[model samples]
Target chain A: MRMTDRPSNEEGALAPWFAAGREAAPLPSGEFMARMEALALESQPAPRAAPAAPARQSRGPGRLLARLRAMGGWPALAGLTAACAMGLWIGAAAPEAAVDWVATATQEQGLSGLDPASGFDYAMLGL
Target chain B: MPYDAMTDTSDEQLLAAYAAGAPGAARALTARLGPLAFGHAFRMLRDRAEAEDVAQEALLRLWRAAPGWREGEAKVSTWLYKVVSNLCIDRMRRRRGGFAALEDVAEPADPAPSAAARLQERSRAEALEGALAALPDRQKQAVVLRHLEGLTNPEIAAIMDIGVRAVESLTARGRKALEGLLAPRRADLGYEDD
Candidate 1:
């Protein structure tokens, strides 16, 4: 932006060489631009859908690896396979599986005991 | 809104709009800039196919960067010049002896008379490319950016990440060397034949 910032060489000297190049040879057509536009259009990422809060899937050994593969293919598959296998093996050796806590807790709490008409604790005996 | 009217819009503006879901903005941006970028690649690399490949890669990068683009810093062309220049330099470095050979100098024969002339023109272009390749890396870039690509000194300095005075010195050195190297074929280049 400052004159001091510019090149010390005079522009008039360059004008002749550039003028000769342009006059003797002007650049060709605009085809290259068209091609670049096509490439840009093709490469643009698609718009993302609104976040619906993805339903949580219970984590499993291969889950992360599979998702990674879906994004990056073979490179990811090679890097993730051993880790995923180890995770799966560890999971298979676990003594107990994770519980359906929501359903189990609801049933165990016996809040289902209040019958509207009878006012009875129907779930008191774990029936 | 019409895209031509969008010409005044900066690349950062268009990229942001494109990321925001305006496909037209992307189209306009590329259409406006493609040739200049491609021409730079072509002249710098001296290979149409390679230039096209570089142009495609650079454009793809533009799209990929659109979403997180921050504006008001670098001009898009300046960024692009840096990207493409680095790519060309990388390619040149990868191929052993790919740079210009000063010893390979040959006089360019007149092209327009016969098959010999055409061959001469091709060889001349190759020789010029080689002489250019022989220059120091910084000089070659300075020459390509300033002369062949028609960028101004300050703009070239920005792209090369150097100061303007450095750009001038580099270009002067580059031109002196090129003229000396090509001095034998000045006639072939339409300069006064030595």
Candidate 2:
């Protein structure tokens, strides 16, 4: 067959050559396939289960809020709010007292106003 | 599907089954895609050992990508062809001292009944392989995929990441070059007539 001729499935100049090539085409040996299968199995990600039907989540923020309300209601909310308010008030009103308490604690621990270098040295001793 | 049922399933479905961790999908894929990958690599590399490595590595990548594989994006074989092609190219680039001369590459032993005919066949195959090796990388790849692997121009284009026209041109040029290379040995290769 001429070079310009398209290669066809039927017998032609190139057909024998292609046939030989195909016959000579190297197949993976059984050992090679086994190794590849092992590698594939090893590399394969563990299958994720079908997600457990999404756990039947509460539909919306409204529903979630409603559930929370049903569990605790306004009394619980009021108590939590009061406790937060009390904590904030103490923080704002007793800043100096808080600072003094921190200072006292540090002094008792022998770390009062220590410079970073001294702190590092002290930390080096596993304190 | 049952393991027996998977035998007749498409490659895409097999890959999906593999991704889903079906019990038999790994074996199914191995039995299916492993030979294609090996043949392609062996044709490209002309070295059985390296080809085996390339095939295993290609399959390993497939396994790693199975979980994230997007079905219907491309045929599993096409995806594998692309991967094997690129891997072979990478290996060729990293080969020390350049491409091995044809004489240095070993040919597999043939088992034909007649020694003379077997030798001639072996020599013909080796000559073709040598000619193929001498081709520029793209032309060689195009020719191998187009002719030896029996893939369509479009499929080859997809694997080589080129347009169909480009694939056609490359294959044509490759065949012409092969014709020139092998013409002088026509009689020896038992192609005496034309």
Maximum-TM-score candidate: 2
Residues A17-70 of candidate 2: C-alpha lDDT, one tens digit per residue: 666776667777889888888877777666757756655555797697797698
Clashing pairs in 2: none
**Chain B TM-score of every predicted model:** 0.78, 0.89
The alpha-carbon deviation from the true structure for residue B170 of candidate 2, after best TM-score superposition, in angstroms, is 0.6
Q: For candidate 1, what is the interface RMSD?
A: 5.0
The regions of model 2 sitting more than 4 angstroms off are A1-12, A50-127, B1-5, B96-110, B113-119
What is the RMSD, in Å, between candidate 2 and the native fold over all Cα?
A: 20.6
Over 4 Å off, model 1: A1-35, A45-127, B96-130
Per-residue lDDT value at B59 in model 2:
89
| Candidate 1 local lDDT, B99-181, one digit each (tens) | 55666554433445567545544555655566677787778888877765667888888888889889989988887777777
**Per-residue lDDT tens digits of candidate 2, residues B1-194?**
56535567998888888888887788878888999999999999988899998998888888888888897798999999999999998887777455445455355465565686666666677777887887888898988887888788788889999898999899878877777777777886677853
The candidate 1 chain B region of ten consecutive residues with least summed lDDT is: B185-194
The native-contact fractions of the candidates, in order shown, are 0.28, 0.57
